[model samples]
Target: MEISCHKIASGKASGPALVSKEPISFLGTVDPETGEVVDPKHQLFGKNVGGKVLIFPGGKGSTVGSYVIYQLKKRGVAPAAMINIRSEPIVAVGAIISEIPLVDGVSAELLDLEDGTLITVDADSRRVRTEEG
Candidate 1:
């Protein structure tokens, strides 16, 4: 299925899907080493984000969130693309600095996407396409 939203960057990628109904907090919530969500209460907790399309409601906590995101990128533990219901400044800054594909203003239905689905994000055109694995 194809859905259009505002894209933070334009790109296509095929990777395992990771969906989170909760917003993520970069501070102390993610493990940069393994790209795993460390927050036990988070829907994606203990899930590896590496090489996956990371989808969440949005970001929360700390202006330094962007720095953490960049660090993850530098460590090669960053998600291939990001989809959010809304874009937070921290996430926006990180996506820009880390050069990761990002799309926001997406519908909550994105949360229904199963893990391992192949999805493409076109940030330039604000589109997201999903196909069966």
Candidate 2:
């Protein structure tokens, strides 16, 4: 199935998804070096986001989170792409500067996408699709 939405970054990626129902705070919650969610309180804590299509509601916490996302990319440990219900300044800026494929305003629920399922995101065209399609 193909779903079109707003493209926040111009790129494309195909990878397994790591879906989260909660917001992510990259600054203190994510390990820039390891790409692991380190905040124990976060539902995704202890999961490594590396190379996956990381999906979440949106971002929270400091704007410095943008730098953390960049750091992850620099360290070669960032998500292959990102999908959100909506895009905020912090996460949007991070995805832009990091060059991570990012799309928002998706109609499907993160849960419906299924964790670990391969999905393709084409941010340049503002579309996402399940591998089956």
Candidate 3:
């Protein structure tokens, strides 16, 4: 399926989709060390977001989410890209500062996208295409 949305950064990315249907609490959800989600109740709990396309509804908690993202990037555990159902300032700021590809306001077809699917996100054109592995 094809979903059209606004992309924050244009680039090619292929990896698993770490889907999070609920809002992620950036303050506690991410572990800076392993670049994995540490929040036990999070759908992506214990899952490594590094090199994955991290998808979610949006971010919650403190505004320092951007800092956390920067730290993750510095640690070399940042996601290849980010996809959100909607854009939140916290997440947007992080994406910009981290220079990670970000797309948002996409359809639920994004949720149907499996973890291991090879997907490309074009932030410049606001497009998301899924390819079979």
Candidate 4:
């Protein structure tokens, strides 16, 4: 499937998708050292975002979350790309500074995509494409 979106960062990446229905707060929800989703309350708890295309509705919580995203990058454990239904400053800034490929303005139906589906994100082109699982 091909999905058009607004680019939030400039880059291209391909990986398995880690779809999340809820918003993410990078500050407390993810471990910068390991890139694991640490929030037990989150649907992605125990899963690692490293190398995956992290997908979610948007971001929430402290603005410090942006730095956390950068920390993940420094530790070499950040998402290959990200796709959001909406783009908020925190997440958008994080992705930008972290140099992670990010795009938003996607349809909510994207949330229905199965986890681990292979997907490619071309932020420069403002496009996301998925292969049949």
Residue range 41-119, candidate 2, lDDT tens digits: 9988899999999999899889999999999999999999999998799999999999999999997565566788888
Give the higher-lDDT candidate: 1 or 3.
1
Q: After superposition, which runs of candidate 1 have C-alpha atoms over 4 Å from their true positions?
A: none
Q: How do these models rank on lDDT, best leading?
A: 4, 2, 1, 3
Q: Write the per-residue lDDT of candidate 3 for residues 59-81, one digit (tens) a residue.
A: 88899888898888889999988
- Candidate 1 per-residue lDDT, tens place, 33-95, comes to 778889888888888888899999899999888988898999999999999999899888888
Q: What ranking emerges by TM-score with the best candidate at the front?
A: 4, 2, 1, 3
Q: Which parts of model 3 are misplaced by more than 4 Å? A: none
Write down the lDDT of every candidate, Cα atoms only: 0.86, 0.90, 0.82, 0.96
Q: Against the true structure, whose lDDT is highest? A: 4
lDDT of 2 at 127: 85
lDDT of model 1 at position 103: 89
Cα error, candidate 4, residue 115 (Å) = 0.8
Worst 10 residues of 1 by lDDT: 7-16
TM-scores of all predicted structures = 0.94, 0.95, 0.91, 0.98
RMSD of each: 1.2, 1.5, 1.5, 0.6
Comparing 1 with 3 on TM-score, the higher-scoring candidate is: 1
Position 127, candidate 4: lDDT? 95
Off by over 4 Å in 2: none
